[model samples]
Each structure stands twice: as structure tokens, then as C-alpha cells.
Target: MAETAVAAVLAELAALEDPKVRAVNEKQGNDHGVNLTKLRALAKQLKTQPELARELWATGESAARLLSTLICRPKAFERDELDAMLRQARTPKVHDWLLTNVVKKNPHAEELRLAWLADADPVVASAGWALTADRVAKKPEGLDLPGLLDVIEAEMKHAPDRLQWEMNSCLAQMGITHPEHRARALAIGERLEVLKDYPTPPNCTSPYAPVWINEMVRRQAAE
Candidate 1:
């Protein structure tokens, strides 16, 4: 029964694939070509079906996994299950969507945050830093903000692209959300100059930390 349902969902996802969409996704490191808006619409239709979600995720196809994150009960997953899923999420979109929709909301979030942060795989470690950035922005009661800066200052420049981007996000979030570390964050962003020349579309904030920090700060002051 489960295999038949999983195959049906996979067929639906396969039917939605478009060569043009895949081309764009390929440039962004996403392997699947399904439109995200449509994917979300499908997820909405599926609602919260944990059994179906597990079936979809087990398919190991990127689009199926992305949909799995949507319908799965985040809290239903075991810590080890989440860890295995993270390891299986090698593609960018699936990995990111899983973190955004499932892992971040799981009760084991903080525990996994600490564990994944120290993972030897830079990809896994990037998820840890992404969670830390969320904490820095929202629930940073016990985090060592200064120590995080210390790590970013020492490691960000040489880290792999995936890990470095998350580290940069943590730095930006710290500067934007915590005034105490704002100056230090800006200084580090200046010195490292990571993403300094990243091509940002007009009116979009640059990922270059100094510019991103200042833009967000300016918006906050305005509000």
C-alpha cells in the first residue's frame, strides 16, 4: 500500500518537471525542476499526513523529499531520524526546505543544532550555523555571541562555500538583532569582505555583511 502511494506521488512530481525550470534550478544547485509555488500548493492539498510524508521522503527524489518536509509532523521525527534525513538531503533545495519546514520546528532543534554545528561534513555544519543564526535573531538567551564571532572571524574566510554562507548569515543576524555586537560584526564583515562583490539585483540587499547589516539596521531605525 505504502509503495503504491509513494510511487503515485513520485509520478505526480515527475510529471511536473520542466526542462526550463530545471535549467534555472540547476544554476542554483537544485536538482529538481518542479515549481516551488506549485509544490507548496500540492503540499497544502496533502495537508498533514505523516505516513504519506514518510513515504514521500523514502522515495529519495528531491521533489518528493521537499514535499515530505511540508506534510510531515516535525515533532514526530526522532532525533536519529532527523539526522539521517539531513544526511540524505544532499541537494540544496531539499536540504534547505527540510531545515526550514521540519528540523527547525522539531523539539530536538537545539540538540541537533549543537550536534550538527560540529559535524565534520561542511554541509551538515552549515545547517548547524543556519540554526544558530535563527537563534541569534530570535531566541538567543544563552548563546555565546562573542564566541560565535570568534569562530566566524577565524573560520569563515576559509570555510567551504556552503558553510561560509551560513556563518555570514549568523554574523549579519547578530549585528542586526543585537546592538552589543553590531560594531564587531560590521568590523569583521569589512575585514573579511566575503560576498563583497556578489551581484545583487537592484533594490535587493547585498549579502556582503557590511551592506546587509547597515541596510537592515537602517530599516529597523526607520520602523
Candidate 2:
């Protein structure tokens, strides 16, 4: 019964074109919206039927995105599942989740996530930096610390002023906290010197930035 439903849902989702899925994905609410509801239902279905997740993942990027969200949420994904999900994920959404969670879970994800540095899309490239910050916190060896710095620095060169400011904030967290690597992060800041006179960083008004900065600083210092 569950398998039938999973197949139908996947089939329906598979019929969606990339442009259509990208359009809907762009509108994804920060709070998950209806997608969260479907994610929960599928999670339950997958519990008794783990194969459903594989089926959903095999469908396409849309299903992969949906699965990545569910796989990151509580009471659903465990360490091993996260491992597997990152191991197989190939979509941008999956890349985002992998960037967001994998480093904290395992050091091996760095190599995979760093490859996104060359991705043509800035969003994916930014996500790669975000993942670099994640792995840097763990102080994992053999990871591309300098390469990550290069990407962030390069991003400030032609990136929009708004994104440049965001990189500044990431710099503060990555540089100020990781003393050993603080110089690398500061190099990124130097590359974004255009931001120094902006009064406040472009997007610092958001409530989340200060809190995130504070926490990241604290964690980096602790590391």
C-alpha cells in the first residue's frame, strides 16, 4: 500500500519539468509551508518503508530537495541516514542540506562540498562557503581551508554588494573565531574592503545575523 502511494507521488513529481520545479522551489517558505507537511507524511511512510526515500530520491531533483529537508529534521534522519543522503545527493537542494549539515556530522563531506566552489551559480558557491565555515569549526585536517578562503575572496570581487556584506559577516565568524585560520578569513575581509565604509554591513539589520555571528564566534573560539 505505502509503496504504491510512494510510487504515485514520485511519478507525479517526476513529470514536473526542471523549470517548473525550480520556480516552486524558489518560493519555498523559510518555515517549510506545505512542503513540510508532505515531508512529515513521507517520513512516516519511509520509516516502515525505507525504500520509499530511495524511490523518492531516485525520482529527480524536486524529490531530492524534499527528501533532504526531511532527512535533516528531527525524529527522521539519524547519522547513518545523513551519511547515506550526502553520499548520494546530486541536486542543489541536496547540496544545500549537505552544506548545512554534513560537516558537523562527518569530515568526509568537505571534499564533496568544496567541489561546489567551481559551480557556476553563486547560490551554490555561497553554499559551498557556508559549508567551509561548517567544516572549519570542526578543525578537520586535510580540508581545503585555503581553497575555501579563495572562493570567499573571489566572491567579493564581482558579487553584488549585498552578498559582499554577507561574506563580511561570514568572515567575522570564520576569522575572529578560528585564530589559526583568522588570517585566511581576514584576507577575505581585505578583498571586500568596499564594505568597510558602508556604516553597517548591507544585510546586518536581520535579527538572525547577530545571533548567528555570536554563536559562530563562540564556537570557533572554543574550537
Candidate 3:
């Protein structure tokens, strides 16, 4: 029955695949060309089917892996399995989805986060930074905010692209949530000058750290 379900889901995904989108997806390092909107709709159809999700994930197709993240039960995965999955993530989008939808919801998240942050693998490190940013945005009660600021100040410019984006996000979160850190965050942003010259779409918040911090602070004050 699970095999049949997996086959049906795979068929549906294949039916929704677009060659043009697939070409673009390949460029972005995704292995499949299924439209994300269609994938989400398909995931809804296969909701909460961990057995089916497991089978789909084993197939190693990008869209299948994405659907697996959506349908798999967080508690059903062991630590080693999650680690293996993280190690297999090859693209930024997949890494983001796996961390946000799968790893962060799992009970082993904190332990994984701590270990992955120091991991030599760039993908794992990206997941760790993403998870940390999520935590900093939400609970943040026990986190060492000052230490985080220090790390960002010291290493952000030198960090890999994916890790740097999340680290910068963590810095922005600190400035947004802890008013006391705003000045220091701004100062750190100034010193690092990370994303300083990146062009932002009109009316979009600039990802440049100082501009990001100021915009977030202004929005918070109005709220």
C-alpha cells in the first residue's frame, strides 16, 4: 500500500513537471523541475504519510525530497537519519526547507544545531545558522546575544555565502528583539559592511546590515 501511494505521488509530481522550470531548477541545483506550487498542493494530498514520505525521499528527486519534508513526521526520524538527510541537501532552497520544516520541528533540533554550527560541511553549517536565526527570532531567552554579536562582528565577512546570509539575519533579529543590542548591531553592521552594496528592489528592506537594523527598529517602534 505504501509503495502504491508512493508511486501515485511520484506520478502526480511527474505530471506537474515543467521543462522550462526544470531547466531553471537544474541551474539552481534542484534535481527536479516540478513547480513548487504544484508540489505544495501534492504534499497536501499526501499529508502525514511518513512511510510514503520515506520512500519518496529515498528516490533522491528534489521535488520528492521537498514533499518528504512536508509529509514526514518529525518524531519518526532518528538523529542519524536527520543528519544523513542534512548531509544530502545540495542546494540552498532544499537546505532551508529541510531545516525549517523538518529539523527545527524535531526533538533533536538543539543538539543538531550546536553540532552543525561547528561542522566543516558548508550545507550543515548553513542549516545550523538558519536554525539559530529561527530560534533567535522566536524564544531567544537563554541565547547568548552578546556572544552572537561578537561572532558576527568577527566572522560574518569571512563566512560562506549561505552561512553569512543566516548570520546576518541573526544579527538583524538581535537588533529587532533586544533594544539594548541595536547600537552594537548597527556598529557591527557598519564594520563588516556585509551586503553593503547589494541592490535591493524598491520598497524592499535592504539586506545591508545597518539598513536592515534601522528599518526593523523603525517598524518595531511603530507597532
Distance from true location, Cα of 121 in model 2, Å = 4.7
| Candidate ranking (lDDT, best to worst) | 1, 3, 2
- lDDT, model 2, position 207: 22
Writing each residue's lDDT as its tens digit, candidate 3 over 50-83 gives: 8888888898888888898999998878899999
- Tens digits of lDDT, candidate 2, 1-223: 3677666756554444355445566654221222534555654555544355555556555454565344433234554555455445544455555545434455444554555445565554555556555556666466655665675676665775334544555556566555676666655555555454444456553223334445566665698
Ranking by TM-score: 1, 3, 2
Q: What TM-score would you give candidate 1 relative to the actual structure?
A: 0.98
By summed lDDT, the worst window of 10 consecutive residues in model 3 runs over 1-10
Error of 1 at 29 (Å): 1.1
What 10-residue stretch in candidate 1 is worst by lDDT? Answer: 1-10
Q: What lDDT is obtained when candidate 1 is compared to the true structure?
A: 0.94
TM-score winner among the candidates? 1
Residue runs of model 3 more than 4 Å from their true location after superposition: 23-27
Candidate 3 Cα deviation (angstroms), residue 79: 1.3
